[model samples]
Each structure stands twice: as structure tokens, then as C-alpha cells.
Target: MFRILFYRPEIPPNTGNTIRLAANTGSQLHLVEPLGFAFEDKHLRRAGLDYHDLAYVRVHPDLDSAWHALLPANVYAFSSHADRCYTDVAYQPGDVLFFGPESAGLPEEIQRLPEITDRLRVPMMPGSRSINLANTTAIALYEAWRQRGFAAGG
Candidate 1:
């Protein structure tokens, strides 16, 4: 399974939806701190709708802590600024898919970090801002899983 990392995510519903996505897709969700809302926020709970228990979510105090936990893996940082399409990558199990906050995408410094194997982007029509955070995560996750034969299935 891929590891989904959200750095300083700013929306409750987005993170909530991702929690559900991770549960259903058998991925781990790692959240870097300075989050916009509490894990116990009612909106978040409502959006997650009892799926939280089924999901594996880790909260890191900072980006450094997250790096300490998730390094030594191929990290693909998602950003609209990237030249490469996400599907172009041959994703392997245990790869890390990283995203940034809803308002601001991943910082330039983080995007250029040595740990990031590459920066990837999803296609969109001209004049579009960007896809929803949860939806983007799902797209990347499913593509990677599909390439792996959706492993361990019946």
C-alpha cells in the first residue's frame, strides 16, 4: 500500500474524506502538524462517519518528524507546478504520495528536497485551479494500486 502524506492540511472535510479513502484503499495517512482543525472536530467526524477506526492515521509534530518516519522510501510530491504526470511513474508498494494544504500547495523548498523522488501532477483543463485534495489522493492511490494488480485481492 502507498503512504499518503498531507503537510499542514487546512480543511477538515478534505482530511475526513481522506481518512475514509485510506481505510477503503488500505493506505496509511500521515498528517504533518499545524493542522487547521482538531482530529475530534465534529465536522471531521461527520465527514468520516465512523470510518476513522478502520483507518491508520499518524499525526506528526512537524515535517521533520514526518520525514524521520517516512524516509528511505520513494516519495512523490504532488503539485500543479510539476511537469510530470503522476501516471508516468512506476509506483511500487510502500511508496509515499505527498500532498500539501488546500490553500497553498507544497512549499518550493519541500518540493525540491532530496527525498522527493519526483514531483507529479494530475491533468486538468485550462483555467482550472486544481482538483479536490481527497479526490486527487484517490486518483493517485488507485492508479498506483491498479498498477500493482490490486495486490492481495480475492
Candidate 2:
């Protein structure tokens, strides 16, 4: 299964939707702290819509903790500034997909970190800022799953 990492995500609905995404795709969702909204945020609860328990969600105190828990895995950090497209990589199971806060994308330092296998972007029309965080995650997740023949999806 793949793992989704959100670094300091600031939005509630997006995270909520992602929780649901993780549940449906059989992926685990890892969240780095200082989140803008509390876990009890009503918007998040409403967006999650009774799927929270189905999702495998883990909260980390910091990036270091996340690394400690998820290292030795192929980490692909998503950034709009990246030259590589999301589809360029041949993703594998156990790979980690990293995303940044909704307001600003992944920090430059994080994007260039040696821990990350590569930085990638979801292709969009010229001049577009970026895609929705949850949507981008779904695209990458499905692409990776598709590459693996959507194993056990039946």
C-alpha cells in the first residue's frame, strides 16, 4: 500500500477528504503537525462523513518523526515548481507521496531534500497556480495504483 504525507496542512476539508481517500484506496495517511485546524473541526468531521475510522491516519509531531517512521521508502514530494511530472515516475507499493500546506506548496528545502526520491508536479495548463491538494493526491494515488494493475481492487 502507498502512504500519503501532508506536511503542515492548513485546511480541514481537504484533509478530511484525503482521509476518505486513504480509506477508499487502502493507503495510509500521515499528517505532520501544526495543522491549521484542530482534529475536532466541524468542517473536517462533516467532510469526512463517517469514514474516519475506515482510514488509517497517523499524526506526527514533526517531519523528523515522520521520517523516522517512514524512511527506507521511496518518497516523492509534490511541488508545483518541480520540472518533473507526477506520471514520470514508476511508483511502487510502499512509496510515500508528500504534499505541503494548501496555502503554499512544499518548501524549497523540503523539495530538494535528499530523503525525497524526486520532486514532481501534476500537469496543468500554463499560468495555473496548482491543483487542489486532495485532488492531486487522488490523481497520483490512482496512477500509482493503476501501474500496479490495481491489485486487490476487485
Model 2, position 29: C-alpha lDDT score: 95
Clash pairs for candidate 1: none
Misplaced by over 4 Å in model 2 are none
Candidate 1 scores a C-alpha RMSD against the true structure in Å of 1.5
Candidate 2 lDDT over 1-154, as tens digits, reads 9999999999899999999999888899999998999999999999889999999999999999999999999999999889999899999889999999999989998888889999999989999999999999999999999998887530
TM-score of 1: 0.97
lDDT (0 to 1) per candidate: 0.92, 0.93
Residue 85 in model 1: lDDT: 99
**Poorest stretch of ten by lDDT in candidate 1:** 145-154
Q: Count the backbone clashes (under 3 Å) in each candidate.
A: 0, 0
